[model samples]
Target: MEKKRILITGAAGFLGSHLCDRFLAEGMYVIGMDNLITGDLKNIEHLRSSEYFEFIHHDITKYVDISGTLDFILHFASPASPIDYLKIPIQTLKVGALGTHNLLGLAKDKEARILVASTSEVYGDPLVHPQTEEYYGNVSPVGPRGVYDEAKRFMESITMAYHRFHGVDTRIARIFNTYGPRMRLNDGRVIPAFIGQALRGEDLTVFGDGSQTRSFCFVNDQIEGIYKLLMSTYHEPVNIGNPTEISIKDFAEEIIKLTGTDQKIVYKPLPTDDPLQRRPDITKAREVLEWEPKTSRTEGMKITYDYFKNLPEAELYKKEHRDFRSHTKG
Candidate 1:
């Protein structure tokens, strides 16, 4: 039997690298592409030896060309972290808009199914609690976070247009907070930020009195939900995340305990437009894909902490987590 060929953009980032591994294990020929803007090649370095995997050093915001048959395309390219998007807002917007448009065109050309990675940020400090797919969201297009939120919103709109007008097969995953190995230690996300502080014996920084809550899904569980969504026939957006919610203050405490650090919790002003609550109503995902997160926070955190704990000394101290020397595309 011939292997199914799939192309995954942002192929060197945390989630994209994992997806590449999953499809290859299923006997698919995987072509991995990334601009390395926020993605680290080190995450996908292990796949280099695999005969079924090929890495393309290219930015998806430009013309995307994949030779031969592409059975599927997973559009995972984007600068996901606030630190990243804030620093490079134009690139973030371009990837979500232009990059998505190009890939949707490719999917149309190939007659292949495409799944674009969307985010819970579409909810935009959501007016609705435990956001559902039906909520239209309360996003501000001009806010600082608006660059990313609106970009993803635009991505979703364009995706559905392509699906409806162009007859291209499409799926959108409204991914929530997910954490695990290969995450940049210095990324502005709460998980890595807290873990990095704990590891360095610094106080955990809590924004906005720490009353804000977020739901975190383990990476393995997240990838499972995404894969199931891609294979399913659903055409609408599906939430892929653990609905279990935790307050930032309490989550900071959890990290201190897990890292065996005696660090204190320090409070800071919340960034503009930061969401106060983020939890997915996964009723659609449960019904459509029959998927729910299976990894417990305790089990998942330990595994994640150990991964960060064992990192080389230099990695722990680097102000910037990404190293782009080798993978930068001219």
Candidate 2:
């Protein structure tokens, strides 16, 4: 059988790179596109010499020209981290809205199946305990974090519109907190923040008295969930994340144990719109795709720590730690 031809946006990112590796391992010919806005080439550099893998340096929001029938299109672009999107708010909104629309058009033209990497942030500060796909989010459009939140919500809307209007096969994976190797240490997310600080012997800053809760799925399980979703018949958005929730304070303690560092855990002022708690109801995912995260936090943290431990001494300790946490509490 001919290998499937897959194109992944944000292919150099943490999730995207891992997805590329997964697809390539499955004997698929993969085309990776990125403008390197938030992604580093080093992430995908290992595949530079692979005959089945091609990396394109371009923005997905811009026009994309390619040949061959595209078997799959995974749109994972956009600035995900608070530090990244906040620095380029306009780009974040544009990629989610315009970039996703463009890729949906590509899927229609090629009759390819496509998946958009949506985020738990779309649920805003959750009013429900564990947010299911049916819950419409409580978003603050005018807030500082609105750029990413509202943008992702718009991405999902456009994706569904394509599925409805153009008869395109689309899947939206509302990804939750995914952590593992290749996570940019300066992304301002809590996991990397705590790890980076502890590795460097700095304090672990916990925002808002450390009461906010989140579920972190290992990258391997997340990539598996996304791949299953892309290949399955299910078309609606599905929540892809671990259901086990942990408070920020407890998460810090876990990091302390994993790294075995005596870093001080400090309380800090919370940012606006941070969610009190967020976990995925993956019942739909399990029933439909038979997918559930297998890597527990303890094991995933060890893998991530091992990866970061190998980082160069300079990159390992030179990040300018910021004071504010992301408002998208999920």
lDDT of candidate 1 over 1-330, digit per residue (tens): 989999999999999999999999889999999988888889999999999999999988889999999999999999899988887778888888999999999999999999999999999998999999999999999999999999999999999999999999999999999999999999889999998888888999999999999999999999999999999999999999999999999999999988888999988899899999999999999999999999999999999999999999888878974444433232
- Model 2: C-alpha RMSD to truth? 3.8
- Which digits, one per residue and each the tens of the lDDT, describe model 2 over residues 1-330? 888999999999999999999999989999999988788899999999999999999877778877987999999998888878887777788888878888998999999999999999999998987999999988999998999999999999989888999899999999999999999987899888898899889999999999889999999999999989988998899999999999999999999988888888999889898888989999999999999999978899989999888988888766645322332232
Q: How many backbone clashes does candidate 2 have?
A: 1
Measured by TM-score, the strongest candidate is 1
After superposition, candidate 2 runs with Cα above 4 Å error: 320-330
Candidate models: Cα lDDT each: 0.93, 0.90
| Sequence-dependent TM-score of model 1 | 0.97
Error of 2 at 6 (Å): 0.5
